[model samples]
Target: MAWNEPGNQGKDPWGNRGGKDQGPPDLDEVFRKFSSRFGGGGGNFNKMGVLLVLIGAIIVWGLSGLYKIEEAERGVVLRFGEFHEIVGPGLKWKPTFIDEVYPVNIQRVNRLNASGLMLTQDENVVTVQMEVQYRIEDPHKYLFRVTNPDQSLSEALDSALRYVIGHTTMDNILTVGRDKVRRDTWEELEGIIEPYDMGLRVVDVAFKEARPPEEVKPAFDDAIAAQEDEERFVQEATAYSRQVEPQARGRAERMLREANAYRERVVLEAEGEVARFTQLLPQYEAAPEVTRERLYLETMEQVFSNTSKVMVDNKDGGSMFYLPLDKIIQGGGSAPMVEQAPANRQTSTSSSGARTTSSDNSTGRSSVRQGRN
Candidate 1:
């Protein structure tokens, strides 16, 4: 709505718009709104005044270019889209809007976790979870020295992870020295990140858990359990053998050795008895009468010790003597030999001590019948 419109006219003392009906403003109001606002005429002079005012305002804004950097951060100054300088944490300034300041945290560290299931050198896949801690070393280099700085971390981490896992067996990744693997991964990751000028230094890497993936977890667990059981069984069997076999062998050997020693002792005793008997045989031979008398008395005593039997001789002249042999034939004793005696008994009397025997048929035995003899 232009003010010059007739409907927009203000009322004066006669009820009309003041400025529009009055046609423009006083010259002093124009001068006051013009030169005071830095414009002279509609010519080049007015344009110069406007441009000068803009330039002066820009100068004032440029002088106020100051910022405070925290203790953990540094300022990267850019002059004309190029690296101007790197400023430490403090009150610092740049050349107004001409120089851009990028504040980068240098003291504080950042952490990231790289975790996944990956294949190992043994053609087995395992789940690996871990954390990585890093800090920015050179802030200026961190911003400009590397392209896609933030994304570079994952690539370097992947490189390190792959390198570490690729060289490790599945078992080692799942157990044993997983901590050392994480440390090695951090060092390798730092090396890769550093070369790219990502301004990241590795503080540490920790493995949360590394194990067989879910698909093969059961199989691995079963295998481990089976191995332990097998080892236990082997140990038990070995211990049983170690405990039982030696004692059994020792017992058997002891019994055999004892039997052998007893055999040797009995043989030595028999040999000694035989030698003594042989040595006494000559003495008995030289004194035949006395040895015979003593033998007779000893035999008589031994024979009568268990029985009251007595030998009787029947004095029938020509008749075959009927011997009373039944009395000596009773009880537990060696059967005494009897003979049908006639001429042999008369000639062999002294040698047999008045007893004789002969080889005969049943007729000789009838003479010594149970009741008849």
Candidate 2:
């Protein structure tokens, strides 16, 4: 028969001997039964369970301390909110609760931009843009030295840029002096951040743009164009001077040499004539008459050599004649003879020989007869 048939005394499946309310089982009895199944007394059961929990907690804590760092990163370790030590790349471990590790990318290059409208030395407002590229050098200083290193670097860039721009001119900033501005800003930025020890290194500073305000852009553009044209013109003029100067100097040198040569030739010829005349003077002083006669004959011979006409005289007082030999030869004809009247002819007898003179109408000169002995 079933237990609930109401024919026997009060009893239940959980071993409740008597109860007004047949509720769930008792907590203390359930614990005692579970301890007995585990083969431990109640006190030993509690202690063993606590030991297992503590061991698992320790394993988890030790496992949590193991961390990995990338090749480009450096690990910064902190102990109880104080900087401890820096760790390099690869697998690393640190105490979980006593130390903290922050991975910082030391090899990564970071960039910041700075731009603003600033007043120039010439009191002109110009907008300038600059870019700074940097990388972390010391991870410890980077994390601990400053609260916000990046923001500090940005502010430093701005300060440096403003200082440089203020000392420069508008024309230079907008045109040829942009590189100078970039370099100066970089130097100034380094100086500003040096004291702060921001743990930032400037890799490069690029001058992106520098221009006048929009309202004056066109005028500045025109001014910049004029400056470029002026530079080009100056360069071209310098090249031209370089090219033409040598030729001009060469021409001047050549003319000077030619003039010197001409002067020397003239002087040498004059000296030769003087020497000849000096030697002739002595012979003329030795015998005046003979020298005079010889000189007169030489002069006549030299004069007649250049003419084509000839004159002849007959010692028997016959008719005198002139022969035009040049015209006869050129015309391929016989010589043409011309007779002269005795009244028109002139004759003189020298001590050395008989002399006869004939007139040549073509050259209007008198010729002395040569064959008379």
Q: All candidates' lDDT scores?
A: 0.69, 0.80
lDDT of 2 by residue, 163-248 (tens): 99999999888878888888899899999999988777899999998888999989988998999999999999999999999999
Candidate 2 error regions (>4 Å): 1-39, 260-373
The residue-by-residue lDDT of candidate 1 on 81-149, one tens digit each, is 888888887887677768889999887778777888788888888888777777888787789777766
Clashing residue pairs, backbone N/CA/C < 3 A, model 1: 9-17, 10-16, 10-17, 11-16, 11-17, 12-16, 339-357, 339-358
lDDT of 1: 0.69
Residue 154 lDDT, candidate 1, scale 0-100 = 69
For model 1, the stretches where C-alpha displacement exceeds 4 angstroms are 1-60, 221-373
Alpha-carbon deviation at 256 in model 1, angstroms: 35
- List the lowest-lDDT window of 10 residues for candidate 2: 346-355
